[model samples]
Target: MTVDHVRSLSSGINQTGVRAYNERLLLSVLQRNGALPGGELARRTGLSPQTTSVILRKLEQDGLLHKGVPVKGKVGKPSVPFDIEADGLFSMGLKIGRRSADLLVLDLKGEVRMQLRETYDYPMPDTVFGFLERGYEDLMSALSIDMRSRMCGLGIAAPFELWNWHELVGAPPAEFAAWRDIDFSAEAARITDLPVHQVNDATAACRAEHVFGMGREYRDYVYFFIGAFIGGGIVLDHAVFEGNQKNAGAFGPLPVPDVQGKPAQLIDLASIRALEVRLEADGLDPRQLWQTPQDWSHLEAYVQPWLEQTADALAIASVASCAVIDFEAVVIDGAMPATCRARLVEMTRTRLSDQDLRGVIAPEIIEGRVGNNARGIGAAAGPIISQVLLNRSAALLGALLHKLGSERTSPFPGRTYPTGSVTGMPRAV
Candidate 1:
């Protein structure tokens, strides 16, 4: 179907009350699993068979869902399946980094429709916001989505250290000078009225994996995002574990044993900066790093020791996490190319496997499927899901509001504003 046609079908739904809740349940099931039999969906979502039938009928009629042919089974009658019309919805995602940013438009199935990227000399909030607004506007215009309501909310992936008010209440230090003390949601709201959601870059990437990538295989896992820096996300029972300050997965600061019998943080040992510094000290020109593939290979050799150390540290962390959460695996993702991820996974597995420790099951370490765009894609998907849920709730609220005669402005929270700042920082390598 044409993009416009699909957008129209999705926009036509009256989201609120029972209808909204039903839609949310239906979409959630479809998202978690690409498709399922109507009976299976009812069983999984805990909705009455009659209720499920009604909701499925409405969704199919609205073009948000479609029915599949019956599948033959050995022991029972064939049943028709329901699947999400993924093309019916679309979302935009943006990842803001210190030196560059990536923007992507994705369909409901998590496929990239279009991408635009740019590099910047400095990380100024105002300049970044201007670039983003223009980029979003240009993308929307290109897509011919003139109506704001036709578009879902915007999601941003950024890096911001979350600390308790008592620990670091004032402005952040100079290391994070560019992003310190900025209220992104408040500022972004002034520029556009769209709903904006902010999340940590690694956490967002983890969300993308949980929703669309390999993590869908396990209910609990630790996601290590290796980029300019090293960051991570912890998922338990399919929900992200954001700590009291919403910063539980700051894996960078976790200390690892060093050669000097002291301990250094993972970022100090594994970050891209560490590799760059090592390469420069070895007589390699730093500027050639990004331009030459061979430079990366050479740098890879120099960091082998650090990589091994990182594997050991990760093994320890994995064992500890498993003891507490019984996590199934530890996933490594981010800017590392596919080959590099494979090598790391292999090395981590071998290292952990060699340990003779008792009662320790070496968790599988797998490369992430989402790659560098994981954060951006997750950022994009966040809003689409939020808006879909909100749209459903809004429909029910509208009916109540009509009966109540404006006694309630909305049953939900006030509209969210945007801030130019991206969410979660890259992991501190």
Candidate 2:
């Protein structure tokens, strides 16, 4: 954003009961624009220098922020840039998918510090919770005691109606039916005292992009994540626009054409599960799709057709999405090879040309920066953003982030405004 525009976005009003708001405002501003000296930070947030200095010093003392090396210009005194301390706080993300589950730990800066993965033919609650319990123990034990105490909470990313996919995963009704009674937040409490948060797995991926990837470049975009099931998330006004039900971008059901020109939901034609089916039909190992240090070169002969079909459907979804929101771009990302993501972007761009655009302005089709396992990465960010950082889009979302987890607790406590200095998107750092 231009300096003038960013300055215009600042909201650093300090009042008797607004200390909580001011602290979040400083963090959000730094997250969006990177580190800044006290004066510039104060100017950006419209806070008096004395108040800014007090907040900055207090944050630094509390380990939420750290100062950079002093830089002396042709000006008066040397200025030190204050940045979020990467090791100041930590959060966890758990992503439950149709074919696999991943658990990861991320620092305040949205960098993954540790990760664990488990794969299965299908999902069962016992297995998922088992992994969560084990992974939680292993990860926490690995951290220093100080960092462990700084853990914000856990964020979960799973499907809205996880049981409905029993047919897709080929699991028995009784096994899948158990998910109906599973409350993610309640389950998390059994494993840790940290507050719990949950989001639609696809929306979590979109959140990952919005906080740490190219989604920040646009005020609005439609995000499609091609995973076990082709799902989606929406971003409006610079934030991940999780709708009233936290399922706004559930784009898998968007109508598209099948290989035979028959009507099909985007998921039918685009999901990795369908590709797995094609591979299994040909006696090729579908397990390779989820293998670590992923290398799909040997499977290229089978992958090309799937990419073509998936790209075509995605192009249509992009058009339909933009027809409603005028998104500046359509970001296509997935738990697949980087080569596949780039190729899909190109093919989707080609297919967009074939779409009828009489009333729609075609959005730029772009490859997503956050690659495979984005769902887990995004999930890990939910708790930190919900509590410690700022979410400018919360006004549009109506303070719903706290609902993701069991409870929301701020590292710095006081009443928080729904929106902060960050104009759009949740500031994850």
Candidate 3:
């Protein structure tokens, strides 16, 4: 069936109740893991083979999924896998950074359809919202996608402190004038008129990496994102664990010991700000240092010490975190290019090898494949995933309620009703 045809049919099922939930569950699984065979879907969802077949047929008929070519196996019958129709629905992702904002239009399968970057001289809250709304509108217009019913919600990822201002105030107490008091979600929602989901940039990167990158290899791992600031996300049991207030992975403020045994914050010692300061001290322009060969050579002279100290601090944090969370490995990510990621991974691995923490398995620190687009793309995927999950949960509950309602006997001790009875009480005993 054609993608548009399926979308139209599924649109009918949007408020059709219980059936919509089953479709959402199927779509959610596909969104998270790409294409998969019906049997695998059954395995993951704990639905019967017959039920899986029924749901798949309905989803395919509705145009939410399409059958891919059969893969020839060495032994048994070729399993026909199903994949999401990328054109079926699209969502927007906005990554708000200190220096720039990135916007991406993503499909249901989390593929980037279009991207735009805007750098800011100074990002005031109001101006940032204005730029974001304009960028979103421009992208939608460029794609020629109809805003009504076709567009999913917008997802945003910003710096941890900016995103979770309330939490920081209770703990470390940041002094950023602009971030001291703000309702980002309400402001953005008012401007865009689209439901906005906000997540920390590092947390969003972790979600992107976990869903689409090398993070699938291990269930429990830490995703370290190194950019202007150093931050990370924790993945436990293959799920991103957003703590009680949805602020779990703020790696910047985690404490580490200095040479004099004084407590130093991780961001203070390991961020790009530190790198820039070191370069300036060595009589090199930080911007030129990143661009020039001679400056890189001079920069590399300081890289070993910088990397060593950074790795040491990271190792300390890792050990402390593992003592509590017991993650299997730590995956490093961020705006760093492939080569830089490799270097950081190597440095972290070497530092881990030298540490003597008895009876604790040292996590294998590795590079993530998602790169700089991790936060942006992941932010885009958020609303799509959330909508799918919410729809599924509501559907499942409706189905359970239907089944319970059909069963005449009340499970409660005080209630019994006659056949075709209007009152919920027993008729004249």
Instruction: Judging by lDDT against the true structure, name the best candidate.
Output: 2
Off by over 4 Å in 1: 1-19, 70-78, 146-149, 162-178, 282-306, 389-429
Off by over 4 Å in 2: 1-19, 393-429
Q: Residues 134-178, candidate 1, lDDT per residue (tens digit)?
A: 766666656644333345656888765432211222333453464
RMSD of each: 10.0, 9.1, 9.5
Instruction: Report lDDT per candidate.
Output: 0.65, 0.81, 0.68
The TM-scores of all predictions, comma-separated, are: 0.77, 0.88, 0.77
User: Which run of 10 residues does model 1 get worst, by summed lDDT?
Assistant: 420-429
On TM-score, the candidate that comes out on top is 2
| Candidate ranking (lDDT, best to worst) | 2, 3, 1
Q: Candidate 2: which pairs clash?
A: 196-405, 197-404, 197-405, 198-404, 238-425
Q: Tell me the tens digit of each residue's lDDT in model 3 across 199-308.
A: 88888888888777887678788888876678778876556766665667788889888656798988867666566678779787655433312234445776667666
Tell me the tens digit of each residue's lDDT in model 2 across 327-405.
Answer: 8999999999999889999999999999999999989998999988789989988877766666645344444544432
Cα lDDT for residue 128, candidate 2: 96
Q: Alpha carbon lDDT of residue 399, candidate 3?
A: 47
